[model samples]
Target: MCAFIKVSIATFAVCNRISKVLGFDDYKFIATPVVLLMLSFSIFVTQNTMESHFSISNIWQYYSFPFEAIIPFVVFIVAEIRRKRTKVL
Candidate 1:
C-alpha cells in the first residue's frame, strides 16, 4: 500500500540520518537491512498483528495517552508562548 511505502521510505531516511548523526557514514549500507528487519519483526510479532492493530485495547490507549495527546499539547503551548513573546518585542 501507499501508506506502507511512505512509512518504509521515512524509516529508511530516518536510519540514514541517524547513522550520519552517529558518525557512521561508512555503514550507510547497513541501514536498509536494519530497517527491513525491524519492519518484518513488527509485522510477524504475533499471529494476528494486522487484525488486532485495528482494534485498540484499553492498555494501549492508556500507554499512548501522554505521547499521543500530552506531548503535542505541551509543544503547542511552548510554541504559542514563544510566538507571543516574539510579537511583544
Candidate 2:
C-alpha cells in the first residue's frame, strides 16, 4: 500500500518533468496517457522480474532501501530550491 502511493507520487513527479521537458504542459491530454503507459510498463517489468523466486531475494537485497521513493523526493527538493532562489533574485 505504501509502496503503491510512493510509486504513484514518483510517477506524477516524473510526468510533470516530462511534460515540462517536452513543452506539453498545455497538452496534458496527450502527455498524460504517454506517461501512464510508461509507468505501466515500468511496473510490469519490475513485478515480473521481482516475482521469480531466485530473483526475488536479489532484488530485495539491492532495492530494499526505496531508492525509487528518494529520486522524485530529491528532484522535488531541488526544484523547490531553484524556484526559491529565482524568486529571491
Task: Name the top lDDT candidate.
Answer: 1
Error of 1 at 23 (Å): 4.0
Cα error, candidate 2, residue 33 (Å): 2.6
As a TM-score, model 2 comes out at 0.44
* Model 1 misplaced regions, further than 4 Å: 24-28, 36-56
Listed in order, each prediction's TM-score against the native is 0.60, 0.44
lDDT of each: 0.79, 0.74
Candidate 2 C-alpha lDDT tens digits along 10-82: 7667777777888875645555786679768878766764376566667666775566677878989999999
The candidate 2 region of ten consecutive residues with least summed lDDT is 48-57
* Model 1 lDDT per residue over 8-89, tens place: 7877777777778878966568677777887687677645755567545635788799999999999999999999999999
Candidate 2 segments whose C-alpha is farther than 4 A from its true place: 30-32, 39-53, 59-89
